[model samples]
Target chain A: MPTRIFGDIPGIPEGSEFESRVMLSHYGVHRPLQAGISGSQLEGADSIVLSGGYEDDEDLGDEIIYTGHGGRSLDTGQQVTDQQLARQNLALALNCQRGLPVRVIRGYNHRSPFSPTEGYRYDGLYRIDSYWRERGRSGFYVWRFRLVKLVTVGAPNQVDEERQTYGETRRVDVTIQRIVRNTEIALHVKELYEYQCQVCRTLVFTSAGPYAEAAHIQPLGRPHNGPDTLTNLLCLCPNHHVMFDFGGFGIANDMGLIGLDGQLHQKANHRIDRQFLAYHREHFLMNP
Target chain B: MPTRIFGDIPGIPEGSEFESRVMLSHYGVHRPLQAGISGSQLEGADSIVLSGGYEDDEDLGDEIIYTGHGGRSLDTGQQVTDQQLARQNLALALNCQRGLPVRVIRGYNHRSPFSPTEGYRYDGLYRIDSYWRERGRSGFYVWRFRLVKLVTVGAPNQVDEERQTYGETRRVDVTIQRIVRNTEIALHVKELYEYQCQVCRTLVFTSAGPYAEAAHIQPLGRPHNGPDTLTNLLCLCPNHHVMFDFGGFGIANDMGLIGLDGQLHQKANHRIDRQFLAYHREHFLMNP
Candidate 1:
């Protein structure tokens, strides 16, 4: 079933037209209403589609890479001495003492170049996990919000009798499960490499930050039986990870990266374990 | 640069609303336009967005798995006696001698469940390379079109000077080239497996037919030096191919399929080359 969100703006159909909610700056106790501002705090709303702190053309992410407030206001684009209320909202969102029920609506942004037809889609519920002041790409101090999606709490897996009677159980109730990875080790390896691909030394910049994935050299789990450790991890960009996983390349016994293209890739770091590399070679590389 | 499309629908704002172009189907001389039908030859159009013949809810592919022209027309839901113009258009699309200017758009169906914002996106210019009559998911005769995107003719290593002057070249002119795969070998392997995953013996049914992908056991290219031959190929479903690529499992020396889940998978057939398997084991699989 699809997720649901509720809130309507006058003069526009709910799921069309607008890609963002009314600016959060327009909310609070004494905001104007005629200009589409909510005069008072509209708490307990199901969802709010935030546009984020990207300048005129910036992308948003699961974790908001917020620009700091108080230097120059985005609305006015003028220098300011006092802290901005937008910054305060970030702090308020982070406050666990008064758990604010701010449900963020997720969807494709129209401001981006390749905007999709999915207007303002409601991804899921989320909460502010962390926030901090940081320097943005614009060289301005911005407040960042690290938001995490709230997973749905479901009842125990009890097959519905009606569904079973129609043979829907085989079709609809099929479940595919995967192992819960050790995010700590993964994150550590990525941080160690500073979000650059180990094989190609490439870093991809996203709306959130430089994005990189941790590849388990020897995959962790039952048949592979590889350990989830920092030594067994390689920080790589998404493309290289896919190539590595697909047997597009491998590492020699001397730690030399062997790719199909014949290009010799130097290892940027030496923390990789030879034992784990050997294990990967024996099974995945296909030549022993 | 982004691909462009043309046409206007009544209420939908141009370039915003609606998922398809109204021209391709409407332009054929004597073609019926009233109920979204064309009576005769549709020519002189640059592009088309065709939503195929799936009952109520079905997905279409670049290779159109078109149900044959008669019996229960999609337009009326009643039995069709003569050739469907929609089917005829597909045939015309496949005619290279005619070479009608037809570019197929690729995107999600607005009517299908979980459709994304990118509905009917203009992917690229394409020409119908092949066509055949096939049995569809609804047990109807369907016409299928195999379309291939036309590559642009460009001079080697020449960067646009205007883009280069502003550093826009770095941002926009970056092109990542991939090795042109040997489709003949890949297709042969897929056909050998009868479009079923060799590891699981599972066939994924699409509106067109069963779909499978070919994997290179020992990757071909400079680093891995695996060949593009039957000895190095494995037919697999998309999911299992990803698993195999990621070193999630391997074929033991004795032809045993070893996976992380420890599931005992038997090889449906036995054409695997022990030499290629040994190479894959040494380099790609990690350990013995």
Candidate 2:
């Protein structure tokens, strides 16, 4: 399991920028990809991103006065009610009272020179100077916390741009290659069937074209590793794909779909391998 | 929809080999990857692959006396009853009566000098020389069809090995790359929560490691194009991933997982983006 990160994340110095919050989450420097703050009341707040989300936020590079969560209307960003001293709001206050350090990140939206031009920038550690309840923005009581940067002895370190992009690109791009192959194979199968379900022999007619899914009789991932071959594949409508995958049915050796009364309508070139059908019957089929 | 090839595939010549049935299916040479014959009773048999599947089948380089489908025990590949003139058997008969040329592919399983060492080899087109109902060695009557090679007035053509591999590799390998990314991200999310369900807050313990699925709020491919970012991802057990994907529920902007009471039990850095939650609520959430 990944350990919870607190205060400064080692190796990642101040002013390190990430293209997306998911990248931030992957690195473990800032855990919450969406939330403004990354800490709790019990442990005291350890990290906060000043994304200029709250109207009351003030960013001055070295010093930041950030607004706490809540009180905003869901539809409109305006504060609908007075802020409460609970959840992330109280968590930030705990940091101020305990004199604990908090990691700070600034988003491009955060209207400050230190903020990233596009994504989110991780500014170094900061000490919460003070906290106070103020009534100004949107005519509602808002909790504000002042934070001062805990300056390091050396100059600000900029992470290598090439290294960060390379790592993130490899991780994210490599994921879609398999999806591409699956799509091609599936599309081919669907075209062969004219987007018709094999078992029911019904076409999912649409404006663009027809739609269908390629289901693996023995499955494709771990514990199964079913071959991505035509013999192991079945083109079906979405309903059947879901049902088959959920173990609602299985395919018999003679192309009969278990749980369904009739056999799958045949396509001359799209024959199912007996081995895969047997595999599904043994490992995946559920009682009708 | 792909038009069924009746006689010869344009580019793929005689003697071209395919490593697997899937590849053969991808190319229009033979449609039934598992079935011996690629035709219907109405359309006549267009192709036949000599895979040495029948005990009484005889293969002479220029001619093949092939056994018809059916009347064999599924558990044991033995003739258990009299083979009838139906399905592919009738289809081959139509080819003989019509004098229609049928494509012939030889598999490594076929005991003949002309068969491929491995995979399936397209030998060339053949004419049905004669067909007869004969009593087999097992004392069961079987429909046997004799095929004579319809020789092309040219040297046999072999498909370029490199070209075939390159095409097939690109098509199949590209599929799992996205799967790899999804796995990595899902694994990271599971580790973040120590393999616990965020919605139900229960740990799924296993011997090797805890299993959890990472679900996307807006989905990743096609019409939605949801980002594979952390904000759009949720770590849930299998039940939830299936239910959520099947549109069982959605997450509100405030992190409340709809259809279930209360908010999602969140980890410090594992916050879901409000945009994705809202997207799910609008698009995927089904009435509960």
Candidate 3:
């Protein structure tokens, strides 16, 4: 007795019997491809054989069997004969479960008629009839298959691992840079001038930004020994930075503020006025 | 003869006369609070004064002297006396100078004032004439004078140095706390799970904040070994944190996800999926 199978029905385990019921609900849905043995050609022969797989019928075979290149006499094996060719044709049709519109195309560079020449095209296509027939002669049968399912999931299929690794590594690198910058600036300021301002008592941040500007006591443009050195730099606010830059002020021999015109007086009256000087005298670096 | 003594200003050693002029101009325009002198009494004194070794003025003894205690008497100190005070008062009236309001209440804090009692009623005021008359015959007088001037302008009296210092110190402390918190959290995450996630290949951040969150693999309220061990903690984002907290999704013995129904599936299909498991398989620590 030949077993029966439904090509459209999913091959689920016995425990998942509900799957067949669900699939049957969509049975009327048209499928262009069909796979099964054909019964018409092999009439009135002793033990008539159907090469293709069985499908809801006992007289047909469960799979197709390839009889090789046809259109030749089987008894003589010399010339292509009509009867031998007919048998081969029957075998191909039964094995492939013919009567389906699905077609298989193959080539190294095949272009679809509807697609652009530069775009991708189907390189090979094998109808269900031919596929089953080819597999039957190779001693293979009952190939299990499942429908392709789509899902909108996080992370793309390609390069997801690489992206994740790169993101993680980049995050760590950024964090380390912040820490190193903070510590390096602090240590540099501490080492130079012993962490003290020459004209103000502010000693909070040593970073190179708005709060603390690494000032050049001697002009950067001027020829000096260590313009970039911490010793030549004084951390100052914008106002004092301008004053010092324009020679409106200077540190006295005793490290006091000497006003413009070479006066040690708080005459210019900039932000670093006398009161600030007093603070500096009490707190700034004594030898800077 | 009036004598003159000139000393270079504290910071301006060259005596920068222009600086003195600038200081005078600043005092005239900005009107900084007078230091080291009572303002209301001496309206005509220069920015600086010369002390003649405690000797009294001898130029105008005949003028009247007003005492702080609501009394008036003849000037008896040598050639100069109340006449100088009268001249200064006349100069104030003539718009050459202005006198500050006399603070009659002594030791009465301006910020927090105390009610006056009988004993301290005239605390800040006293009579110089009566003080002298009470001690001797008539009144003694001597003669000596000199000239000096202000050289530097300082901050207004409103600038509270102590309060500013306190504020700066507070800001520094807060910054340090933030830095320390960031470092501690980062280090904690690095140590836990040995710097890898059991479900994803994300690395711990060196800085704090949104980089990492502590996760309990089993759960907090469970009776298992959820007592804050490095093994129990898995650093994750807010999304992953919530998913692992409420959803019954967990890593199986092979580090693959075991869904809520205890089904061990390498392929994730549910909402709380284990898509990040592939990276973790290669990077994360596996016990078995």
Candidate 4:
């Protein structure tokens, strides 16, 4: 049941602290141990913690505000009634109507120097930017929200879930041009493989960096065009650049590891150009 | 240093069991705790257990003999000297001169009913087949070896290790004839995706069976020769069949998940042929 993760969790970072809330539910940042919201009115909200627990929250180090859970009164912290929007408050109003972001964290309390003087911190992705209902200081009503801070990384409006298959599902889109190489030659072969994976040398990391990819070795476009040079790149690790462009494995003029199981770590000043590994074993191996 | 595995470790099986040897080193199975051998002499002996710590070992369910560690005597099991051929006994004589295999396990003692009435069990993959050096009954000069028990899976003498890649490395081998298809229509679309992965339902397993991989949505050879029909297969799982034959992602006509990040999950009576997803978005999505 942990699958809710909206913005950044991979390799966590932002102010990062944690010591409890069961270590922010073991690094999912804020996974409700006593419920300061975590998610679900059906999959909407994906995190939250803030911990000034509502006398109208308002953290302000990168804007927060928060509140929304239930009537209050954990033994006279007062309020006692009117607070329902329903489950994780309609899951943070469906991450403010689906622009999604969430995460946040903060916690500790001594009255907000942006909180955390003892435990939870995380402070990273936000964007709920609006929500309301009001009336507080114990006269009831409650709800609130607000949010903000999500510095940079804006494009791709978040959506990534692959792993699909089902034959004959009519999918169709076909516009073609191809040869799109030199993004600084795939970031110079992914910083010459420090981003790893020349076939399983692995190196994932992610809150957006250290990932690895490059790949191409022959065929840059239509009918085996094969070349956008740097001897046709290779870095790999997006599952070995889609298993070396979909023909699962092959590479052996002494840099061994022919294919399938894994472990070919080589590094010596890279050198791949054996005619693009003989055009990937003549157009991708079919059992030999 | 563990990473010596040879025939089968993925999803362990053969009699399985383990309660300690530190729970068989947290399931890389027999990874030495009180050391009854577990690889290295530059990667050789990958695992062994055998309960009777060598009184001229024997066991014999499908054949055994074993022994070879050091010359005995923790007190009076005697022969405390002359036993070297070097660590893990030249790693079980380099798995009896490289026919590789190894793993074994057993360890329970009452002197064998095929052992294991208690702690370890595993009993699978053996093959050392012969070693020698002899002289003991507690007299000294030991070593023995022999083994056996592998059972079937004959061919593929086991090499498998792709992930080696060095630029300019002279790799070559091009014999292309292609068109192989029909292994029962990719095992009937991998048992209609019960072998899961239609995008990422994932199914892994691997004691040798449940792994997925049918792929093909188009290109079956050369200039996209396409066809071998079933509206061009898909099953996937080897990293989504190399990111849908390396375009990485593209299946929208209502199935969404276009080019990367991933989470597609669809299922129904498979039907896929939209001109093979429009020939994989015009020969592998070059963005847009």
Candidate 5:
């Protein structure tokens, strides 16, 4: 009855009840129930739940939100109502209209320490975009949904049905030419840093207002053809444009800031060209 | 007659005449006409042609390739004929039905060397999925078409009409949970590396045949909780999985082959747990 086992196990000969699974098998799916503390609760679980909590996943930045689930009560902290079963899988992830597939079960959230050590994982495919019925951070009565993430984007000669159902063999279609930047020179260098963040000055408001990120410093397509000028841009703010595209830091030539810590202040009036800060310290900080 | 200019441009005392443009101003565009050495003719000009030549540049790619311009017959070596605006932009890029957008102008053929430094710089939209006529390499007959990159996919409460006409603001909406594997343990470790590439053994084939890439060597999410077993996988081939996930190399604790140079060679039948290659040489080669 060898149900499924593979590779090196030299010592399992002693007990032999045939229990070598390792991971990925959560069998029949469907688990959602928790409550309290939701939006962005990483270590304590919930993972994500926006909108119905009245928006605040960084104010729904990056769009799509309207997410909610469960009416937890675990005995007297009562508020569990709206017809459960994870609200019928949020009405079957909102009528599966070409999207529905998610996972992350973990011992049904006991205020989450993710102890699922085994039994639920897949985590992809989502698409419900909208649902309603809220009011329950214990005050009981929840059920929001808006989902998103079904991400299928393939048609360039199509062939990515989940990487061909995960058998994913070398695909290669290649043809990436590039050269873009002329939205009036990226909105005149993000209004000359007025949108903020010339190095953690952090601004980011939003609702259609302040929000930075222009960054470029020696990066404008294939093998650094860097030249979109304003001395190769950089207003930043998406966490310092992913920490200056992950070189973690750089900027000196007396303009100071060599690997983070500060003092490259000019605040604005345009004058950055120290040969593009020595080409971002010779291609991303002395070659990262 | 002020024509689109933005922000700070002080000073010009030494240049009494005035000329500070910096880029972008190709007015009333529509200039595609050339010939000669076409395909693969990189640095001699022709920037791109793959068949019928005409005139249409609808701000480059994302859904539009009904392109066709003029043919060049530069002093003798001739074949330029198929007229009528390249047969009505190849019957509107083979009948719109849901496609179009392209760009690659460079001194209109005549043996390439990409010199479209300006007067054309959007280049990023294509979709002609298929077209035919063949006979070229100059003996002229050309009409090919095949182009692909159209990519659109949005719809979860929409908003990505080409990144809102390219004004792309950091849109996040993420919910990407992972952990999918177990297609019978990735097909028994690609039949125990029989699919090839234990460090450049290569084996790629295609048309639905041989193709490797199992990789893993301790890497299963969250600070590498790694454990999908089969001695922690590795079949490789996407250029050695980007050189073994960019630490450029690993696998020595006497199983040999540390920073690249071959031989852990077992060929099959299991047994490779040198403590998961010493946890890929202590978490990605001595902490990278």
Candidate 6:
């Protein structure tokens, strides 16, 4: 069956876009009213009545009205019923405590409560859960209604814009720090070795980030050149650095690298030795 | 004591730069010349000799002069010396080929060769392995040489202008094919689905090559509309692709992915599901 109902609610300011599809639930102090024909009887009904009225207003001014799902009413400043006020309170509480915005709406209507065991039935008043907000020049506004009984104490707010902003800023700061550190190390090593490894002739662009790693050729604890000095350092990849540290290889005085096993280790076969040599030859401290 | 001798040898044409020191053994033709210094008391003393004679009749008529270390002269037309020539002939006959271009000028000039008993030694002469033709007003040349005899080959040549032009042409052909294939699929699906795997978005760039794998959402055997569409395709790392193929996890219709077992059967505690979800949310794929 087709149902007609006021799409836009009154009293609540408009301009809030609908964020997500509304969820239907039972009515309570904190729960918004749900309205939908039972699945089995939906084909039988020809038309449905949607009711809207101010529970606080005893006069007949509070009355049910029928309009298409997407239709809007002329009344704009009608007072919000007690049910609508309850939903607004729930949304406010959720927003204040938690950081997620509520995405439910209360339409202008009331209907008989549905029971799971019942096959199919409808009361005179039709309860509607679907609602829309007014779209302004800039943004849209959302409207919600809650029954007072469903409202709980100290419920977390769904949205905290300020806290979210701070968290985003923190994440950005951390990323920037990582990039800066990586760049600084890469550049310093490349500059120290003049863009090539002393042991190997590996060349890199800009000598910073991803391409090189700053390494202490001699152990830092030894009484020798400063750790940061270009002479005491060599730019190498992780594998080469590990091999060099274990004394598995050494650079000869003549600038050629000597592997532990006395064999010619070409770059194709011995990656660690080749990478270290490339870095040393391309970017290393040369005697003045 | 440092002894110096100077003179010019014929046939070495002028304008060719020569190193001050050379290894006598590098001379493919003149092995006996080096023998003169070995076992001789003068081995410990630095000696220099000069070879001077030039046939003014030839275009390359400059006398090649050598100083530092002991030296000997040979006729330009003569094929080295008898002893070295014999060894060269034997090697050529055994290998069934002509000998390479080798030259000898001086001996015992720099560091002493280690492992005197071993036939192999660090000869100072650098060998030219290969060459390629280039383009333009003056074609560029690439030479690979090493400081030590063992280090025979240096770094590979970079992609020069000629190679780059060829590469661009090849790239254009491949790109056109890719564009045609992509156009056949919905453009939005390609944009919506990330090029990386929905799981462990591992993007590893290594010296060997770049790695990435494209995958299909629905198995190829399945029948459906847009089954092989771009929206159903994903580019994933190798590890993640294997996991998906084995049905370790699946993405729900609501875009939420669910995992079967706690972890992959053979793989360790690599929570593939969580990894995929994390990247999906962090990279805004879920919202996108």
> DockQ of candidate 6?
0.01
lDDT of 1 by residue, B158-246 (tens): 22221102112221112111111244466567777787777767665422234567778876532345677777888876546645553
Please provide, for model 2 over B238-257, each residue's C-alpha lDDT reduced to its tens digit, 9 standing for 90 to 100: 54564465445667777776
Q: What are the runs in model 3 whose C-alpha is more than 4 Å off? A: A1-288, B1-187, B192-196, B203-210, B221-225, B260-288
Q: How far out, in Å, is residue A100 in model 3?
A: 59
For each candidate in the order shown, give its overall lDDT on alpha carbons. 0.42, 0.64, 0.26, 0.60, 0.39, 0.27
Runs in model 1 lying further than 4 Å from the true structure: A1-288, B1-148, B155-181, B261-270
> Model 2 compared with the native: what TM-score?
0.28
> Mind giving the per-residue lDDT tens digits that candidate 3 earns over A7-41?
21233211121122123223321121222212223
The window of 10 residues in a row where model 5 chain A has the poorest summed lDDT is A172-181
Candidates 1 and 3 compared by lDDT, better number: 1
List candidate 6 segments past 4 Å from native: A1-186, A191-211, A221-227, A260-288, B1-271, B280-288
Q: After superposition, how far is residue A228 of candidate 2 from its true place, in Å?
A: 55
Docking level for model 5: incorrect
Expressed as tens digits, the lDDT of each residue in A1-288 for candidate 1 is 122222222222222333334432222211222221121121212334433334622333333322334466568865344223243433333221112223443345434432345544433334444333333455544444444333232323221111101112212112100111244466567778887777767665421234567788776532345676777888876656654553446776676776443332334654667888776654434222
Worst 10 residues of 5 chain B by lDDT: B172-181
Residues A171-277, candidate 5: write the lDDT tens digits.
31111001112334655787777767777575644212354556777665322456767877777755445445434467876767876677755654776777766
Please say which candidate is ahead in lDDT: 5 or 6: 5
TM-score of chain B of 4: 0.24
Q: Write candidate 4's Cα lDDT for A157-230 as tens digits.
A: 21111101101121210000011124446656777777787776766542112445676766453234566666
lDDT per residue (tens digit) for residues A38-66 in model 6: 11111111112123432221111111212
> Tens-digit lDDT track for model 2 on A189-251?
776888688877755432112345677777664335677778888887655665565445677
Q: What is the TM-score of chain A alone in each candidate?
A: 0.42, 0.52, 0.22, 0.23, 0.31, 0.24
Instruction: Choose 2 or 6, whichever is better by TM-score.
Output: 2
